[model samples]
Target: MRVLVTGHRGYIGSIVTPLLRAAGHDVVGLDSGLFALCLLGPAPENPPEFDVDLRDVTEAHLQGIDAVIHLAALSNDPLGSLAPQITHDINHHASVRLAHLAKNAGVRRFLYASTCSVYGSAGADLVREDAPLRPLTPYAESKVRVEDDVAAIADSGFSPVFLRNATAFGFSPCLRADIVLNNLVGRAVLTGKVRVLSDGTPWRPLVHVQDIAAAFTYALTAPTDKIHCAAYNVGTEANNMTVEQIAGAAADAVPGSTVLVTGDTGPDPRSYRVDFSAIRSAFDGYDPQWSVADGAAELYENYTRWGLTEYLFSERFTRLNHLEKLLAAGVLDASLRFQLIGAGCE
Candidate 1:
């Protein structure tokens, strides 16, 4: 299999790209490489790579790609809200546009990295793949729209598979601290402070970057009929846990770490739990294989050995906390967050 991965250098793509290669498939990574550090590793030297923004996607970009794995976007809910127009244009509109072009160009399989966040406030819904979608954020809305577009385009012969991924964690060279598990662990390791933004009650499902990579690796080889126009919520259902539970897990993962639940934290209305049985039934024996506790420990060990704590304490270099970095990715500008941050930095 020959696969073209967009946003190939971002958190999930970084992990998925390597797994695809190990699966004995030829991989061609296409990315803006903006959200991550300069992508390194071996390629065919001349293997396909691109820096085009999603909105500007052209036929030249789609030439000869067999399977398309679209992981490029604003990459988060808060960032999507940072610039709704750009989010809608790139994440929503351009994605559908790119898939359309790929379909026309004879791409056989299309894999999309959707999010479990789409089942916002799912409450006790158990979030099945067939559950009614109630997207609450621009990020979730873009995913919902793109999933719809992928399904529609499938009638035209594009076998689209949507992976509504669990909230991701774990270490990657493109380290992101915005995520719950990583942010908590990074803050604990670097500043000795684990700040809880929400009331420690909002349920966020956890998955490692490698597990997400595993899901994509499975999609790449799975029969087209099994995945075609189908969406699967990836990750363990039992992992749907509270912020505090995750915080404790991270704190326990690192030595001498302090977990702080700020009283100033307010309720996060977008809280919800999920069920992953549908995917297990579909892909039989689909195990997440990594728990939050295990992932936190892994992150802690890696950070300690790699000097990741130095960046966290510096403030300016923290991958997940710093918004200037996000802007540098063409998602936001430095002025936006600090300007917005002053209004309580929420």
Candidate 2:
């Protein structure tokens, strides 16, 4: 399989790209190089890439690509809230366009990296792939839109699988400190405290980045009838934890660190317990092995070993803050597109 992985240098993509290669698939990359400089450690060995933005991807880039693992977008709620229009432009519009182009280019498989956040505020019930999608934020809404529009374009030749991944944790070379587990662990490592601004009552299903990579790797060659226009929640029931419980795991990972539920921001509405049974039933061999406790420990060890600091944690690793800084620095324009001044952007 020759695959074109969008956002191949991102937190999840950095890990997923290598796994696809190890599975004997030839991988090509397409990224805008927005976060190319936000490396916590050494840079990763990237695949041959078409250094272009998602909105600017041309038919030439899709030539000879067997499958496309679409992962590029305004990845989180805060990033989406920061610029909602751009979020829709890139995440929803560009994504649907890519699917049409892929199908026309003879790309057999289109794997979308959707989020479990689409099941926003489902309370105690475990929401399945067919559950009511109540997207609370622009980011989740964008994902929902992409899934609906892309699935409409699926046919006998083109199979679009939606992998609705949970809140991703664990460390990658292109580190992201904004996610729940990663943020809590980083705070504990740096400040000896795990602070939860929200009352710590919102339920968030967690999954390790490696496990997400494994899910995508499995989806690449899975039976077309099984995956075609199918949506699968990509986290185990075992990892469905509250914010306070996640903070507790972080505290346990770091000695002498205390968990603080501030309740400053009140309760977060982006809470959902996801059901992963569908994926398990389909891809029987794909079982998520990472627990919240294990992921917290892994993040702690990696953050310490890589020399994480408070400054970098607040500025570089956090996507919203980093993009804001880029915009202020004139490296990125109003629409979040990189200026051609930098070598990476060029």
- Indicate which candidate wins on TM-score: 2
Question: In order, what lDDT does every prediction score?
Answer: 0.76, 0.92
Model 2 scores worst on lDDT over the 10 consecutive residues at 337-346
Off by over 4 Å in 1: 38-47, 310-346
Candidate 1 local lDDT, 293-346, one digit each (tens): 899999888778767745443343343345545455545454332222222111
Task: For model 1, name the residue pairs that clash.
Answer: 177-320, 327-332
Residue 122 CA displacement from its true place in model 1, Å: 1.4
lDDT (tens digit, per residue) of candidate 2 on 1-346? 9999999989999999999998899999999888776888788999999888999998889999999999998899999999999999999999999999999999999999999999988998889998999999999999999999998988999999999999999989999999999999999999999999999999999999999999999898889987789999998999999999999999999989999999999989878898899999888699999999999898888888889998889988999988888788787889988775563311
